[model samples]
Target: MVNIFDNKEYLSFFCFIFFSLFFCVFMLFLSSLLGGKSLSRYKHTPFESGIAPVGDTHLHFSVKFYLVAMFFVIFDMEALYLYVWSVSIVETGWTGFIEAFIFILFLLLSLFYLVRIKALNWTHK
Candidate 1:
């Protein structure tokens, strides 16, 4: 069997990995050794703009918020794709335009479906 250490590339790769791990560990060790230690009461508490935190940190969120967020992300990504296609319109010609039209058609259909299902409605129905 050929020794992996005999190959220059394999040896170099192993050396690089070893050095990377050593550097990370050494940096962490140095930081801990040189870092200051604080045992103040507020050390473990959540702080905001030098103000003490009040009330519960974990508040219940409405599912509508997440639904709207997902819709925004999906539409925003579609917009990005359209922007990219528009930038390369000259290269893609009519074919790109047709494809984009079809994509937009599907987007509109999906939006309509969501509206029909009252997905965007904030009212609890």
Candidate 2:
């Protein structure tokens, strides 16, 4: 029986990893050796568009904004799943089609639930 670790592919993999690490460490060392360390009074201060900021930098956002963002992310992920399933429809055959159909059904049900709960409504209740 041949050892997996003794394979040529494993040798190349190890060499690739070793070189990647060496290159990264060499670049970091070179940068630190040649980089500047100058300090000034303005070094720690925040600069925004070359203008000094005024008033309170921290601002509050509405919870509704967060809710809308969550909804967008959920629907976007569902779209991604459907796209992948579509790409391999032939390989999946009838089983894949039924699974995708159920997935779509669930997606529509969730959307309806969101609507019924008024979660998508923008106006304050």
Top-scoring candidate (TM-score): 2
lDDT of each: 0.94, 0.94
Clash count for each candidate, listed in order shown:
0, 0
Expressed as tens digits, the lDDT of each residue in 6-65 for candidate 2 is: 789999999999999999999999999999997899998889999997988888998889
Q: Residue 72, candidate 1: how far off, in angstroms? A: 0.1
Which clashing pairs does model 2 show? none
Where model 2 places Cα greater than 4 Å from the true spot, the runs are: 1-30
Q: Which stretches of candidate 1 lie over 4 Å from their true place?
A: 1-34, 49-52
TM-scores, each model vs. reference: 0.69, 0.73
Q: Write the per-residue lDDT of candidate 1 for residues 1-125, one digit (tens) a residue.
A: 99988899998999999999999999999999999999988788876899877778898999899999999999998989999999999999999999999999999999999999999998866
